[model samples]
Target: MKIKKVKPYNQEEDKTKQLSRMFNTISSKYDQFNDIMSMGLARVWRKKAILSLKPYKHDTILDIAAGTADIGIKAFEYITPTQITGIDVSEKMLEIGKEKVAEAGLNDKISLKVEDVSKMNFADESFDAAITSFGIRNFDKLEESIREVHRVLKPKGKFVILEMSEPRMPIVKQGYLLYTHTLIPFAVKTFSNDPKAYKYLTKSMEAFPQGKEFIAILNQNGFNCLKYKTFFMGVCSLYVIEKYSS
Candidate 1:
């Protein structure tokens, strides 16, 4: 399937570059905006995503698109990961994340780097587990990024993804659409310096493949869907997939 590419500025630059710029632009207020936009549900969702990794060997975890290092920081609360290596394209975002990690005295346990997932420098089977939260949709090369995750993960290692998706039900879908299309943009404009970033974010969420479609993509990229769960009327989804042993 040919997914429509949604860029923040809709410019000639590639999505990765545009996304890096967009996140960097909004890095300061990104966490604040998330809290207001999701009404604190994002915290619950992040905890759930992290807790799902408990059954696996997640000692050395790789966090993809680890913006603000939320997932890495929170992983400490739910699981006993020895180390978490977070990679993101936005340097500014990582800077803030580093500050948070330092303040939490987690500087030694978590490391944040400015690296693209599609072209990571990690070796084969470098991590015991890999995870991403609300970040896969922005991949400029989604397939390649998935493939990279597969390559870096140990055999049968888990790769969990937490992402936003449109609700499937009738009444819930109506309310979700209203909230995303109306209130989300309004909130961004009122609170963020880069309103266009959230505009691109909503557009990307709409265009990106979700649910079964996303499972199919993962299957083709050397992963097997282990568990699929939707929260809050499918507004967000958690996909737990494992690398093929063979």
Candidate 2:
């Protein structure tokens, strides 16, 4: 079966541009919204993902699609990397991220830039580790973006991703669908001016490949030692993989 492309805005603009505009519209309220919607479970998921990179220290880490820099800031808590570089298409998101970095007294360790993942600006093999949180589903060219991430990661570099997934348990699946299709959209409508953005988020999650299928995509993109774990009865997951050295 052919997969349909899931995009925000559903306009002529590409997914990247639409995502930027959508994120910028909610950048200021992003963190608060997350807390309310997830009931603080998102932080737990992020902490687990960051722990996967704890064994590496003094390495340069890339936080791709690092909206608001939450993942990057959390990275600092688990590992003392020499430098943390964050890139996102949303300039406003990066702006808020910069402020958070400085407020945390991590300005010296972290930097934020506006960059597209499908065509990243970093030189090949520039980063020792990379992490992205809930960001891959927004990529217009999923495989192509993974290839770019692989290109910049050093040999044996770790790439960890935290993203939403569907629950496998039958009852959980029903509840999950209800929360996403109705409750999430309603919450977005109440809390955010751009409810369509959250609606697109739910749609994108539904369209994205998960579990073993997603691992196959990573392997095909030159990632090795791929492993994944699910949380909240598979409502979310963490994929930990590495770049092939040889």
Query: lDDT of each model, Cα atoms only?
Result: 0.93, 0.88
lDDT of 2 by residue, 32-110 (tens): 9888778899999999988888875438999999999998888888767889999999999999999999999999999
Task: Give Cα distance to truth, residue 60, candidate 1, Å.
Answer: 0.4
How high is the lDDT of residue 82 in model 2? 85
Cα lDDT of model 1 by residue, 1-246, tens digit: 788888999768888999999999999999998898888998999999999999999999999999999999999988999999999999999999999999889999999999999999999999999999999999999999999999999999999999989998999999998999999988877787888888888889899999989999999899999999999989999999999955
Evaluated with lDDT, which candidate comes out highest? Answer: 1
Evaluate model 2: give its lDDT. Answer: 0.88
lDDT of 1: 0.93
lDDT: worst 10-residue window of model 1 = 186-195
Q: TM-score of every model?
A: 0.98, 0.96
